[model samples]
Target chain A: MSSTRKSQVQSSKVASEQIKTQKDIDMESDEDRNDENRNDNQQQSRPKLSIQRQDGDNTNATYSFLNEDHTLGNLLRNVIIKNNQVEFCAYSVPHPSEPIMNVRLQVAPSCGDTKKVLKHGLKRIAKMSDVLTEKFQNALDKYENRMSD
Target chain B: MYGMEQINTATGFANAKFGSSKGQGAKGFDEPEIRILELSKYVIKFELLNTDLSVANSLRRIIIAEVPTMAIDLVEVKENTSALHDEFIAHRLGLIPLQSFNVDQFNLSDQCACSSMCAQCSVQFKLHAVCSDRDQMEVNTRHIQPLSDAPIIPVQYVNDKGIEEDPILIMKLSKNQQLDMNLVARKGNGKIHAKWSPVATCQMRKEPIVEIDQDKINRDLDIEKRKEFVALCPREVFAFNDYRNAVEIENSDKCIQCIECLRFAQANNLERAVKIAEREDKFVFTVESTGVLTPEDIVSRALQILMRKLYELGTQMKKYGVNAD
Candidate 1:
């Protein structure tokens, strides 16, 4: 009974045709379901990083980092801008609600690759974090010792 | 920032780096240092010197968002005849902070191999409360008991005199009202939910640089003007010096950059007499923990988490074939 009702609904939708082919209707519904599934997948799984390079320029590029905010964006841009090879570096979150950080980098031709610059900046930031951790630990220890005394 | 070259050339691609000698570089670019100003069990105050604002902000953000702790995430209600709804009780249970020093022993529920929850991934707690004879009864976290013998427990606050304070109240039960439930505590970070955040308040502020020209104030302004200028600062940053008959900075750190004194100085046509600026390289940080972890532990863990994130990004970039030539 439900199938007959569905068919009746389908037929009324396609009333312009005298007799709409059942196979065509089934194929159209299947395609719509597949499109919905594809959209669901896209919404569920966003890639970690997406890179877009200028048409003829390897030195200028924009990188979009998924699940990132000002924490990574500001640090990476600061480190990248400090590098002599970098001509310009800036980052923006694009939208506060979305967890997307876009960083634009333009480097000197001598540097040659923007990805390498980004990787180098990451290493530097990591090293800086290492230093911060060590210093903080030392300070904590000193404070504890003083309190104990 | 100007001494960036010194650090860049320190371990040279080509040898002979700049600022190889000690004590002769830009303020922040020379070295980063930390000084613990105050430390308690739950609160810590520190100064991060010679660091960029971006670096300080990154630390602040990581401490707030990435530090992991154990919190009750899922609750199963067996019988709840209380006036409150099940979801309201479940949400209150989730917000309670558990002692998570041993959080490293458990895996995140999603990362664990368990079908739903297991001993290695989650801690089970049972709460049973009933008001039989009393007109009113209070239900608190103390009534919630752990199913197994794990170190994880609800935070127990202590007063300065080392006395255990009253437990956190969850609800009040009327006559014959009973509540029975099972709670599952899992390891997570603030990014997932604020209940898992280890810190109550993690904040950083720029070091205020307040300058008052005593000589100019003494020469140009009279006692009335000096009193008015001192009263202009809402934070009491300026005090009138009766001896020198000048307006002087009493407590510069109290200045919140209100610019009241600066406006008054400008109105008096005293150029550069009162200046207020912030040290770009210095930041004062205060961290208050939610009893799941100590403030010091939170700071160290945040730095470690940040390092891990950077390392993961680098590896991920390499996996995508972004390696150097």
Candidate 2:
């Protein structure tokens, strides 16, 4: 995804596309599970935005992001780690030549749900990235305007 | 803070308090809220709150001395007719910061499972520079090329036309001088050598503060004298507010604490006119990278390295009945 984006210099399109792909991937992961068990888990709890992990248990979750990651994985790990519920979070590309990156998250049982917290943290990071993109554009515009003036 | 005097009253020496009523580093131990004041590909300025002195110092040290990076470690000089000695050229090669994303595949030479030095432990680069022309020519990093199949090594600077330009001049070659060398690069941390240090500059300074006593200024001296007192600072830390007709500290951080601003006040016998000091707890950190890695990446890797070391220390001390968390 990073190669396709080719955003050595960041752009708004690349930023939004990353978030869009992440959301899409999350939804697809959600679809992989049987609907009946998801219904059971939903009926058991009425909490807001309950994100049940399909391929993971309560302890750990691992997801593969193809090309959508490069340095962003390291950043996302740091972001998710801010939460007290997180026991550990790390992302690593298996090899430099490979486009795949794996983000692994571990949550403490004493805290909240792992999947919800991780998803929420990703959302917050996406929003923060968008805000940073805006700030960068504004600063560049201001510098250009000053130069022109 | 509870000094020696406050220690006698409560439940013996074990219960003596220094922090807030909560406990020793308990309340503020939560994840610090990081605020990015400035950022770019090469340099970044950021602030974080709720950090004690040691934690903040560790971060500064990590950025300065812990981030693992790729640097030329061993150089095999096959032939050298240049004025520079072989050892000097090898040392120079060891200091060049190579641009590449360091992968986990390469290990610190000593820690690698391979018995002999191999590709898993090092990357070989060859430099052959000779002035084929009659005039004098300079040798640069562009002359160095990775002889290994792995293409992890890159020049620090690339022009808009995609041509690579060596950021540093390796040496200058005359008509007859020829410098040829084969160098090996390995992944290592700055803790082992300064050449592996990622960030160009990682420094932290206590946040500066300024205190102004308007009543003292107005009562002791006339408006003209007060303006003179403010302008006495060599750093121009003070600027006159035209609307308020008062001399105020416009840029307090510029204060060098030279006590130059105190001259007029002391001359007039009013010593309380102004004060400048640095906050002991609050620190301003600036990190600049060598373009090998982004400044943000440098900071993140610093934090991760520090945390990993602390974790390792905790785990290793478990035999002595110590817990990490």
Candidate 3:
């Protein structure tokens, strides 16, 4: 009886060891699956940004228009001036009811002509705003008409 | 007197006949001979020999008669446009979410006899755009053809906005531009295809048709049931035909024939009495191989079916004192 009891104890110890090892494997597999799922979710959720280079190089700085309330002056002041070009980026809003920030930068004939650059850049910016505003007004008129009907 | 000359340049002769001539003293007949020739400056010459000179002269007079000549001219025009413009318009109209667009190569060809490379009917353009938005956008394209009469091939454009499970946008060129492209084939052929313009096909509302069968219509004539069907209809095509005291399917012209109505009717036991007929004007609805029938034919057939069902329903409703609309 004692011998049989000893054998039973040994077998139980072996079975318990097996179960412990299997549980460890299962835990590792679960962690691996969780990691894969997280990676796939991140990849799917990330937004893809389209960038086009006007001059075929990063030298001609390009800015993305982010439809947000950020000021252009603040963005320019913060972003580093690289390769003699400054890029301004912004997002587009869903509706015209939202406020739009007008970012204007001066272009000087000579790099040293700061005053002329500022003047010319401001003028160009004004023209751009006028064109954009006209488009917005037309869109507003259409929306209002639809709402009335 | 007229001079006689041999015209050697003549390739063939017409209106010549051979016959035996008659001898004078012995009363013997002799064969008459004639030579036919063509001359320069719109003239034909004929010479007669032997006994029957009078017959040869008559043939010559008839042969020199004025002949008419005709001239004809043919002209053909060839046109081509760049496919990039289409992508640009789709992008601008929010049909293609800005982020989902990729700058993959695009190529298009039409049924022109020219090889796929010919300017008469081929276009290719490439674009690369990445979506930078949180909301998904849906784009549906309609009637992207060189001509308005040309067949419409469905194209899809989408942004990252993932708003709905099934999103679609419809696009078409303005009627005037489509007409001009069809008419002024030479000048307008290649110009319209090159660049994407903000034309009216973009940002237009999608009109869909819903057809209800007339056969299975419920005789109980519940006004609430009719209203429920109309409310469930995505296109609002259901209307009450007061004249027949029955539900009338309105705007059958807009039906894409998706068979949503059939499913609805089956579930509700709305009598299978209604026969839904698709509109002939749907973009992909093509004439059968027999040939294209006129609008009148399609309408008459639809009306015939509709009227028959209305009459049947009218007879049933008369027992209930309900008049057919």
- Candidate 1 Cα errors over 4 Å, as ranges: A1-47, A54-57, A94-99, B1-29, B242-245, B320-325
RMSD of each: 9.8, 17.6, 41.6
lDDT of 1 by residue, B1-325 (tens): 3334344442232111112344424422346899999988789999999776789999999898888899887677777888998878887888888999999999987678888679998898999898999999999999999999989999998777888999999999999988888887888888777888899999999888898788888789988988998997899988887887777788999989999888888899996888898877789999999999878889999999898888888887887687653
lDDT of 1 by residue, A44-135 (tens): 67678888886778898999998889999998887677666777788999888777899999888998988898888888777778788889
Tens-digit lDDT string for candidate 2 (A26-131): 6775565456457647644532222225553666767555442334465556556655556667777888654466778777777545556555555544344333
lDDT agreement of model 2 with the native: 0.63
Candidate 3 lDDT, A50-72, residue by residue in tens: 22344433332222223222322
TM per candidate comes to 0.83, 0.62, 0.19
DockQ winner among the candidates?
Answer: 1
Chain A only: TM-score per candidate: 0.72, 0.55, 0.28
Model 1 scores a TM of 0.83
Query: What are the clashing pairs of model 2?
Result: A1-A67, A2-A67
lDDT of 2 at B183: 76
Q: How many backbone clashes does candidate 1 have?
A: 0
Best-to-worst ranking by TM-score: 1, 2, 3
